[model samples]
Target chain A: MEWRWDFTIEILPRMLSAMLNTLLAAGIGYTIALVVGLIFLLGQRTKFRLCNWIVRECVEFIRSTPLIVQLFFVYFVAPQFGLVLSAWVSAMLTIGLHYGTYLSEVYRGGLEAIPRGQWEACRALNLSPARTYFRVLIPQALPASLPGMGNYLVGIFKDTPMLSTIGVVELMHTANALGAETYRYLEPYTMVGFMFLIISLPTAAWLRKFERYVGRSMGITK
Target chain B: MSTQNHPLELPEGSPLVRFSGVTKRYGDLTVLDNLDLDVGAHEMVSVIGPSGSGKTTVLRMLMTLEKIDEGVIYVDGKPLSHMERNGQLEFANEKYLRTQRTNIGMVFQQFNLFPHMTALENCIEAPINVLGMKRDEAEERALNLLDMVGMLEKKDQHPTRLSGGQQQRVAIARALAMRPKVMLLDEVTSALDPEVIGEVLNVIRALNSEHKLTMLMVTHQMGFAREISDRVCFFYEGKIAEQGTPDQIFNDPQNERTKQFLSAVLDAN
Candidate 1:
């Protein structure tokens, strides 16, 4: 089948709206993942043996399982258990939890990269626990954490297509619908691929700049 | 989450810091074994020993950096590592630990200044946040301390921008901002370049002669310790082998181990 420029132009508005939905899904999911990642990171840091073990196991389980399976379970099986969330809600929760485990590992790696001397220094200064983590430690952790966090941000954006199987009207879902209705698969699928490229490329570049700025502000050259 | 106690907080004339029958073990290797030591009010004592002799562990325990496996540490007449629990001592609660930690400050071998903060920020953070001092007051006192350490001009520089000696001076100023009654110097000059050791030693010398601070240091610089320490203790295998005024410990050593260690150390220098 020949590629149809006219058909592509005709469906451009719908695809644009679907692009917005994709961004919204990625944005909201990333926000949830950022917060949930911190919660998971704190869980890993706690001293309670059972709690630490439980949280560690949970993170491992999430990271090991496929995101699509989690999406299916959240969208399909959860309703049987009486938690009947919308497709968007289920997808967001699954993506947040799945990527959140990855992000927690990033945070753990960043924290471990800090020298033991920093902790001893905080003890020596007699800084409170809250002050030590927030003011002193986290600022240093950010420079080390930014690259991994940026990687997962892009990872989550790419994985938003998995939401389509659960029937959320994001870019890929919109493209599939357009293809089925017009009996033409090429233009819609190709447009979707180009749109993702247009967005992801600039985001990766911007994240690099952001990482450098964060490092510079934290007195970490290179 | 346990109720706390301060059994060592007796009112009458207790030592400023004491480790009573303290023991530290790492797996099966004992680091500090049944250690007993005392620092009186406003005294300067230097601990000298070869590596792994537990000189650094002594200061680290007093600073509450290391846990005591078998005994109690007293600071400012109160329990430091343990609290009295129904007539028995247990690992201290956080409230007790924090209360004791405020009485002590430490300088590290690596001069671990907060790299993200300027020297002035490093000095004032504890004063304003931990001590709840007003910002202007904290800044004022921080500046004076920077000036005293001869780091006043570089107060705005981050630690990464400073030389090792300059950073150590700033670290000293930072510790002084806490107003700690006891200061621990754990090989403070050991990490510096040989040329810059004199600058850091000069700051410490001024701190010893000019301030009434109770200072305990673990040092390899035998000459500096002999010159500045009021009392010198030679440690061997986690215990003090000999202790006395500098003249007695250095010139008239009695313990054979002390003699051997000093001769080996002095010959190396």
Candidate 2:
């Protein structure tokens, strides 16, 4: 089919509104990922053997299962269990849990990146364990982990389209509804693809800039 | 200056630094088995040995950086690590340990300087934080230490920017910033280039003569150890195979281990 100017012009405003909804969902999903990732990371580092094992198993299970299945499970199973959640809430939780597992590994890798001698030096100076982690370990670990964390940020952004499968009225969902009513698939789908490119490309670039800035500030790069 | 007030005294027969039947084990391997050692006040003792002879372990144990599987270590007539009158094993009161450790400072083989901090900041960090000294006082003392080590000009540079020898010198000054009576040096010059090693060795020799800091060093540099050390302890297979003046140990060579190590190192050089 040939491109139709009138059809594209007519649908432009509606598609823009859907784009806003998609951006909002992505922002919420990322915030949840940021917070839930820390919780999962702490669970992995906890002293309790059973809790650590259980948390690891849960993270691995969630990670191994497809995000689409997770979304469907949260959306369909929760109502049966008498704990109904809004489509938006279900999508956010699923996305958070999905990405949190990866971020925990990032945190662990960063914590281990610090040389053993740094810890021994702290012990030699008799710094308390609390002081050792906060003053020496975290400061060094956080910077080394920044690049990994930034990669996950981009990954989370790309995964936002999966929310559409669960009736979350995000970009793809709105595009589907518009196409069903108008009998026009190409315009909305193409517009959704363009909107995603607009958002993700700049975000990836900004994260790259941010990673360099963090490295320079931490003195890991000259 | 304050050395006169310190008096440099060991109470009667008590050792200023003592390792009483200390044993260190890593899994099934016994690194230091029932080893005992004593360092008198104002004495520079050098531990000489072949590889894996447990010379570094002795220094690490004295610095309280390594745990002894058996027996106790005493410093200045007090147990360096033990329970209080409550009669329970503890993680060791960190604050008390910090204070006690101020008397003993250690320089690592790799120099292990804080890479993020400047050379002056590295020297001043422990004094200000661990010793609770005023920032101005610590800065002043650090500058004096930088001058002593001949690194005052490069005080603002990061450790990575300096040569390995310069970094070791900065580390030595950082350790001495605490005015420690007993200093531990673990192969500090081994990582340095041959051309740069002399500058570090000369600095250490000057510090020993000028400040009379009681030094315990684990070194493979037989010539430097023989020249600077008053008493040399030859360690082999986790035990002190021979102990005597540098002249007796190097020239007379009482133990086969020392003789073998000397010949190997000398032939390599």
Candidate 3:
């Protein structure tokens, strides 16, 4: 269980390679979450009552249930339906769908934070609904929503280790494999935790700074 | 004798705005019920009343921010919120509605200026984008408007940095930028401090005197309303209980509601 400098140094290159895969997975998952969140937001805003209700229920169900269960279901249940996806695809799809629900609420909150008078002002100006949303609403709403969205990005980054469960050789899986081969849990596991803290801490700090910058610009500074 | 023989023509000045049997409701709750009212063209008409009297609703319904459960609103003899083809009420197309909104501009209790935009940018936004004026032209007009409001120096500042009075002035400039035929004021001064209220009211009074913009204001500031408004309407419980000139309503009140309202406002030290 004692830390060994030579062994840690020897495996550091392999761990760094796996770190690249982990970062890539987080990037893809975050991208999918961003786009899918907008889709769900649009679904909730649609006029049809049934569509709205169904989307609401589905989003609520997804939001309430555990992401691990959802991931397992997608990874396991799909093969029974005569379809198969690579572990990376399954992980991305699950993470995206899971976080999409939370992000949709963030989008909704941002939209609602806008005063009713803003919409009336747009109407008074005779802007079309499309222009109103794009030029006025979205510009304000996106900045208001960014902090929440940034938090989710960090959440997705931390959750990338879950990808290792489905056989994706991300940081956690690489640590596990290295530990088994070297018969040393302390070095690889501790190194994996350090790698996460190193990447995520600065990213979280950057997101906070970004949120402050946007808040100042939007006049919503705390 | 020659002048008499030639026949003198009387200048035509009557009600330019007419609300006919207008009713507003939220489900079973009636906010404005079966109301009829009128104001002469280029006249400043103030609606004064207690809370829930539908004074604000009158302005809101005119702006088409609220739908009428019944009745019609006409501006320069054109129907609002409905279409008339061959003298029949038909579903108006959105294009028609869009054109209709341009004829009327409104100011609210809240300044409602786009917070992210500078005062000049807020003034010019609608003209360039919605009215499709060239950007330079819009900016020029917006500058002129800010100059009129005496906020030309502060045009580059955002709304949050400006005082409540300045924000309201910018909002007034924004509303006037459209060059609307009818301007609706919904307690524009209520949110400002007493000292700042004078500045906003001064801008409005000047606009009324200089340009003759037809104005309908819902207000609680009885002194300002009395000094500026040509006529006053007493709205009580979703109806116009009485309406007349400021002299008639204030000096020689006829309706009990108007008497009670004036007494209350005057009595407040």
Interface RMSD of each: 1.4, 1.9, 1.7
DockQ of 1: 0.64
Best-to-worst ranking by TM-score: 1, 3, 2
Off by over 4 Å in 2: A46-51, A72-90, B1-13, B84-103, B124-129, B133-137, B178-181
Write one digit per residue (lDDT tens) for candidate 2, span B178-265: 7887899999998989999999999989978987878999998899999999899999889999999999998899788889888888
Clashing pairs in 1: none
TM-scores of the candidates in the order shown: 0.96, 0.86, 0.92
- Going through the candidates in order, their DockQ values are 0.64, 0.40, 0.47
Looking at candidate 1 chain A, the ten consecutive residues that score lowest on lDDT are A213-222
Q: Candidate 1: where are CA atoms >4 Å away?
A: B1-11
Clashing residue pairs in candidate 2 (N, C-alpha, C atoms within 3 angstroms): none
Please, what is the whole-model Cα lDDT of each candidate in the order they appear?
0.90, 0.81, 0.86
| Candidate 1 fraction of reference contacts recovered | 0.67
lDDT of 2 by residue, A89-154 (tens): 998888888888887778778879888877776666656666666666776777777878878877
TM-score of chain B of each: 0.95, 0.91, 0.92
